[model samples]
Target: MSERVVNPTGRGFLLLDSHPAGCFATVARMRAEAGGDAAGPGKGPVALVVGSSAGYGLAATIVGLARHGIRGVGIGFERPAGRRTATAGWYRTIATASMVAEAGGDFTFVNGDAFAEATKAEVLDLIAERFGGVDHLVYSVAAPRRTDPATGVTHQSVIKPLGAAHRTRSMEFDADGTAALREVIAEPASEAEAEATVRVMGGDDWALWIGALAERGLVNDGFRTVALSYIGSALTAAIYRDGSIGAAKAHLEATAAGLTDRLAPWSGQAFTSVNGVAVTQASTAIPGLALYVGLLRAVLGDRMQSPVEQSVQLWEQLTGARPLDLDEQGRIRLDRWELDPAVQAAVTERWEAVTSATIGEHADVEWFRTQFRSLYGFDVPDVDYTEPVETDLPWPT
Candidate 1:
């Protein structure tokens, strides 16, 4: 078959084929950061990672397999390959599973809505039949909407500020010509909207997953679970730190605390991990985050780390000999690097001076665009995009 083509447009780039090289690059990074294979392990520990198909979850899964030689069961919601479009997460999952199998690790990919009780039941059955139990449960789920199992109420997350509308510079790539910066205003979210955001993005589902697992006797003793969260600088506070999503994060953090207590009998621990901001599918959808990420990247420069790198750091801290370090809020601080005073100062300086006219010169627009495209399996230097690709690739069985 010929290599898949990439059609770039203003909205985003669509991949025509599965870029194996790009996927392999992700694996290579995982290996490098892990510092070679871990010693003395029988297929390592087993892990169940929700949202393991992409973003932080994908990187974490890769690290588990490549670095620690863990057997992995991944649950993700992804669009199947259609006549006209192929989902990047589907391909990434396939590529990741293939690599793990080749490296002599067991991997299973389940594509479905993680919030559904049926999906949770499926996970429990799989673990019973295969790995018996999981040592780690990583929750990195990001969704625009979530349906409550009890109330049957579906809540949609909004990216608006909480109190007042905030205006900021936004960047967009023009498929026709040059990149453009425009003034984007994010309106305040209503009380109901804020509640809905928390309902969708909050940790209710996460808590439910743990409860179900524990009740089913699937959680092993000393098992640990982690949910990813974020706390950026003050610059984006209105729409981020103190915004609707922030309310959700607060709920998530609180959930972690409550779950920790619930799991105390089994010596299990639950933690909310504060991660650094990166170019992710979820981040791009946030109203004014793209501009901030671009500026943050420019300001951080070499200090900025990718999800793969951050995953390794997290793994080391969790699995290493030393006890995990947490902030006063009882959360892992993976975002400490990003929240450094020097970095924030620089970002603030740039944020204040940035305008439509100066955005091009001040922001790392190209880097942001490249990272965004990379998530979709495009713009990898080693990948041959000119060749025709097989769109109907099989999922890892």
Candidate 2:
């Protein structure tokens, strides 16, 4: 009798680990192609990553070290771990920071808020005193709740569509890809709501952090910066593009434009990566996304690019390759892959077949859901979930 074991990394580890590496590689290439020697930039960079605990930002930190071959400092302010639940990204950071140090690179983690002036000051002081100044800054913050530093009012962003409530069927893969009836989702947000969403997501925090650092003499000329964003697909348009999140991204794109202008004198530019969708801790919560993931999986091939792969692709764009193909809004448009004629043809075809007139458990959807469930450290075939999961994640200092 033999027992099967599913490794933890098998779930979503690759997306987390390789994502930043791919982006950094692209950044390095961009630096090289710009006819600018990549390494002359201020003894490399003391890299500062906002939202550095998980998702795209953490990947950026890891990628900065692994792919870019640049070494300096890393800083962020993620809340320390709490009772019972451990953030997956934090663990990955530990492992990644250890890898960076072993290779003789500097990595530092300061958990808190990117928007907080105090936190920003702390990051700058750390960089100025110990590592000189940061040569690059990566803004990847994605918080849903923000208290206006001035107003003191707490705000929460919703994951709803931007237009009138629309009825759509998405998958609840946790129970197999049953075409669960997604009720007509909420309507488009008001201008005030949209602006608030943007305030939390837009480039204000990023610009502020960069400005503070530069003012403190931590920025050298030719520094580069980037932020993460998404445009999803037509299927997710209401919930994503026109939705509250979409509104925020719109503001984010504008934020980049402003940052680009502000940093022009330093020969620095801020670019936004219209990153593709993936099974991330963040992406899962977006309304109508589970179905998008399932269909996207069937469409992108069994090789649906993991977040790490997507990040690599992102890196390629960031570092002087081709600015990612942009939309009318002048924002990166990687989400176009979701709506490509060929890719859409495939997902729609499978969706129709699986969710046809005959309604029962879809074996294909079931398999996908199982894999997805495994992503959250549940329902894996290889490892016993009952066994306490042990890891050796090295928290970056």
Q: Candidate 2, residues 154-249: lDDT per residue as tens digits? A: 666666665566666655422223444343456667667777777787766777787787677777777777788887677777888878888888
The per-residue C-alpha lDDT of model 2 at residue 358 equals 33
Each model's C-alpha lDDT?
Answer: 0.80, 0.60
- TM-score of candidate 2 to 2 decimals: 0.78
For the record, the alpha-carbon RMSD of candidate 2 to the native fold, in angstroms, is: 6.9
TM-score of each: 0.94, 0.78
**Number of clashing residue pairs in every model?**
5, 26
Q: Which candidate should be chosen as best, given TM-score against the real structure?
A: 1
